[model samples]
Target: MRYSREHKLETHARIVKKASVRLREKGAHGIGVADLMKDAGLTHGGFYAHFDSREALVIEAFAHAMDRSTERWRKLAEQTPPQKRLASIVNSYLTPVHRDDPGHGCAVPTLGAEIARESPKTRKAFAAKLEQMIDMLAEQIPDVPRKAARKQAMAILSTMMGALVMARIAGSSDFSDDILGAGREAVLGRATSPKAGKPRARKAAPSAPH
Candidate 1:
């Protein structure tokens, strides 16, 4: 039976969302298209109806995952105070709750390695979302130049992602907690203002060197 356009779109969305979760839980290549479709309550044969190929589904799924992550950070940042926004974000991300829920957490640490080896199209799509995430993070930083803030955000995110991977590898041991703690401290340090709650004012240039 043919489905209506709206229904088809809804079903396609369901598949992408399901795939997003599964792809994070499992590695990028760990689960096949059939399993993803099955999880989405559809048949493997119907996968092509929504996507041109497995890679297509993966690209969309990865983008969906990153979008969800960005939305989450946006909400958190909204609730947090201006000066503390970046710290709040870092703390939220480095906790056990976030670490234990890769399916719902940030996609960078979970899917970064696999995406590294994916087709250029997939990597390009991932990079596009990654750029948005970096920008979102940069917005949380205060008392810094935009270029410097973005650079700091990128460094902070990279450190956190690597620490998260290590923490996951270490499991629930002290090592895991240590990794998380270190990650939080390292990133939060960058996010923290040197003087705390005070902006560094740029000095005025002398008038035409008089």
Candidate 2:
């Protein structure tokens, strides 16, 4: 039986949501299309009805996961004081709970390396979402200029993602916890410092006349 337009849209969203989780849990290209469809409660043959290709599904899923992450950060920023917003976000992001649960956490640390090998369209989609995340981060920076805030956001994201990846790779829980703690401190310290996001001023040129 054919489904109505709304039903089809809902089904499509379900597939993307399931794909988003599984992609983080088992890297892009780790799980087969059939498995993703099965987890979505649909048959393999029906996959094309919702997405043109696996790459398309991946791009959509990546965007969905990033959107969830951004929304969560936005809420955290709204509830937090302007001065402490970055610290709050960093603490929330680097916790052991988030570290242990890759399936439901942010996609960047989990899927970023794998995405580098993907098609241009997929990488472009990821890049766009990443910029949105940076913008959200920039908003939390206290006194920095816009350009400096964006730069700081990039550095903060890089540090957080790297630390999480290392934490996951470590053999022991203590090491993982250490990594998370260190990362939280480092990011929060930079974020809260008065000079953290300030751009360096250029030196004045020597006077032309004696």
Candidate 3:
């Protein structure tokens, strides 16, 4: 008895989707290949048929999780106009709900640091997906240049990731709230302000006085 290629591909997709959720809930390093397989309702040995190794699965799963997260953000953007989208994105990213629920949250805030230590292939996948995600976010800001939009998106991402890391490390709700709120204010205020497009004034050149 053999499975058709379409069936195999469907099974692989199911496994990857389940693995992505589990990977976010529990850090990627925390979940064993066997456990992930069992959680996916598939036999452990079947894992090799879909992916070359656990590393391969990890990268795929990360990509899957990222895509899910990005789609959610895009949908939110669709409901709002461009002028308000970035602020909405920042507020959503910094909430306690996003902090407490890793399974459905962005991969960058959950497992990005761990992915950095992974193989170049895994890192490259993250980088490529990250750029695509940022581009989609940038599209929500009207009249902004590509480079400026990219920079704003990167800053928003960094602030969200950094705030979550600090909140997790501090282990205090008060501190966590402070970190999240401050980060949210800083990012949203700066990114949405008119100053976002204005160039900084340079100091006057020193005079060659006689």
Candidate 4:
């Protein structure tokens, strides 16, 4: 018995989806072809039939994982109040829950450093997906200009990622809290402050003119 093309495609997608979760749970280097195949309920021999190579699967899994993360954030942004969304996002991203549960968390702070050493194709896909995630984030900020929104999104993401990384490196709850708390305060403060992103207009010297 042979599977139809549609069935094959569906199976392939299933494999990739499962692989994405596993990749997020364990960094790309932490997983292997056999382990992913078993987790996906497929034989190792079938891996090549679905993807050209592990590199291909890595790219697909990276994109899929990022999509899941951003979609989760988008849902939260939609339901949460606009004024509080940035803080909420920052708090959630820097929590111990997120740090302990890499399987369901943001890939940027999880495997980003590892991905830097990966194939160029994987890096390219990651760059594009990150931009898409930023765009999704920008959508949640209706009051800001497109460029400003994107810049804000980038800043938020950068802070969140950096905070998470530092917390992990610090290896202590107190340090983790301090790192996350400081980052949250800085990001949310700037996000909520009236003068954020605006340049102060310099007053002219009227006496000098006279």
For each candidate, what is the lDDT? Answer: 0.80, 0.82, 0.75, 0.74
lDDT of 4 by residue, 4-110 (tens): 99999899889889888798877888889999999999889989988999999989988888888787777777767887665555655666556556676778888
- lDDT by residue (1-210, candidate 2, tens digit) is 988999999999999999999999999988999999999999999999998898899999999999999999988879878998887788778765677778999999999999899889889999999999999999999899999999999999999889889988983366676676678668876322111112224222111110
- Clashing residue pairs found in predicted model 1: none
Q: How many clashes in candidate 2?
A: 0
Clashes in predicted model 1: 0
Q: Where in model 1 is the C-alpha error above 4 Å?
A: 190-210
What is the per-residue lDDT of model 1 for residues 130-149, given as tens digits with 9 covering 90 to 100? 99999999999999999999
TM-score for candidate 4, please give it.
0.82
TM-scores of the models, in the order given:
0.88, 0.89, 0.85, 0.82
Off by over 4 Å in 4: 190-210
Best by lDDT: 2
10 residues in a row with least lDDT, candidate 3:
201-210
RMSD of candidates 1 onward, in order: 10.6, 11.7, 11.7, 11.8
lDDT of 3 by residue, 29-127 (tens): 999999999988989988899999999999899999888778877887787777887767666676656666678778887788898898899999999
